[model samples]
Target chain A: SQTIHQWPATLVQPVGSPLSLECTVEGTSNPNLYWYRQAAGRGLQLLFYSVGIGQISSEVPQNLSASRPQDRQFILSSKKLLLSDSGFYLCASTGGHTEAFFGQGTRLTVV
Target chain B: GESVGLHLPTLSVQEGDNSIINCAYSNSASDYFIWYKQESGKGPQFIIDIRSNMDKRQGQRVTVLLNKTVKHLSLQIAATQPGDSAVYFCAADNQAGTALIFGKGTTLSVSS
Candidate 1:
């Protein structure tokens, strides 16, 4: 079975502070990884996605960036956080056309 | 750029009733679609998926219907419960191994 893990399930960051969220997948290799942000009462916005290590595609431009250091390890980072950055961030992995499994998610509160 | 969007922003239904949510996609090349449920303070969970080759697929109390002709999709939940109250999103994939384009979510509120 495949399992996805995310850390700092909940985060509170002051404005202009740095941000880092981690996501790791087990039981799969070379899977597609994605970062999505969903605001209250809004649809998810794809921030970035990686098909392989050291390769990433940005969907929406923002202060956030993504990196896939390993085959199954993905990280979302920001040099400075903004109040608008507050939202629910999700990490997803897909082995194929099969359903994409999501992590528990990181609730970022930028105050 | 092409995108996926929902027909409604919110839906309210009575417990034990069936619920249906609709989505529209602009990408004609999309060959795969998925439905997801996101509860409060949680990540989106996979509910069901349908391929472009098929028009419908069922899982437990949920059914996903795909209309490639209209580029529309729908999800039907049978005997809805309060626990089914969540934000539902539809995602589309045009190319294999590509990032899915997600639709704006519809908040389903089921009242007992």
Candidate 2:
């Protein structure tokens, strides 16, 4: 079975602080990875996706960035946090078109 | 200009009743559609999915219906329970190999 894991399930950061969120997948390799954010009562907003190591496609222009250091390890980072950056961040992996497995999201609160 | 949207923002149903949620997409190239359920403080969980070639697909107590002509999709939940209360989202896969485009969610509230 495939499983995804994300760290720092919840975080509160001050304005202008650096951010780092890590996602790792177990039981699968060479899978596509994605980073998404969901605002309250809104749809999910795709932030970044990685097909292979060192390759990342950002879906939106913002203070956030993503990197795939390994085949199953993805990282979402930011140099400075903005108040608008606060939301629930999710990490997902897809094996095929059936469905995507998601990790328990991280609730980020920027003050 | 491709976007996905839900017909209703929220739906309330009594426990043990069946629930239907609707969604619409504008992209004609979409080949796959999926429904997800996200509970409070949790990530979205896969409920069911239907391919373009097929109009209906079923899972454990959940079903997905796709209407390619109208570019619409729906999720049906039978015998809804309190645990089934969550935000439901539908995503359309353009087969672009990028990612699924998600629609604004519809909150399902199940009351006993």
Candidate 3:
């Protein structure tokens, strides 16, 4: 199936609020998953990626952290959101050296 | 630092014409490259890809050309249509070779 499920297609939270965005993949084992943030009218910024459970890499140091608790589940979290955290957040998974599959994405707004 | 950038932010073409979108990568070591098309409020979808070992690759109506020497890449669309209007981005494996990186993207407007 190779499907990715990302919830809360749109979110509005206040600054300093906790944030959690979840993504789960189906039909693949040990797939590489990624979290990307895209600002309005800008390119995608790779925030975090996980090759396997408990093996996460941070591409950019920010207010966000990612955890891969299960082989097919990846989570993006923020203890305290910042206004700058607002952006279009996407979850993706791929087989190495192949095209990555993406979820619908969550549009977050920090007010 | 590794970076992928586009030469133009916007490109316009008339229906039935051909369109070319260009990208440049900073890391010469990057071998895997791909092109993606993103519509408004939608996730980017894979269009085509080429490896550094090859100079060109083609899909249904799209072609990807890679120039390892110049560190350049381009996507050519044959017979552009208004339905093809979207933002096109180029991606390459980063220096770490663990994740793919993306460029700012070029908006291709195909007028009918």
TM-score of each: 0.95, 0.97, 0.98
Q: Which residue pairs clash in candidate 3?
A: none
lDDT of each: 0.91, 0.91, 0.93
Candidate 1 on B49-94: residue-level lDDT in tens?
Answer: 9888899999999999999899999999999999999999999984
Model 2: fnat (fraction of native contacts)? 0.67
Better of 2 and 3 by DockQ: 3
After superposition, the stretches of candidate 1 with alpha carbons farther than 4 Å from their true spots are B94-97
DockQ of candidate 3, scored on C-alphas against the true complex (2 decimals): 0.79
Candidate 3 residue runs with Cα over 4 Å from true position: none
Which candidate ranks first by TM-score, i.e. highest? 3
Tell me the deviation in Å of residue A96 in model 2.
Answer: 4.0
Ranking of candidates on lDDT, top first: 3, 2, 1
Per-prediction fnat values?
0.76, 0.67, 0.59
lDDT of 1 by residue, A6-108 (tens): 9889999999999999999998989999998988878888889998999999987899999999999999999999999999999999876777888999999
Top-lDDT structure, candidate number: 3
Write candidate 3's Cα lDDT for A1-111 as tens digits: 588899889999999999999999997888999999999889999999999999999999899999999999999999999999999999999888878888989999999
> lDDT at B33 for candidate 3?
94
Tell me the lDDT of model 3 at B104. 93
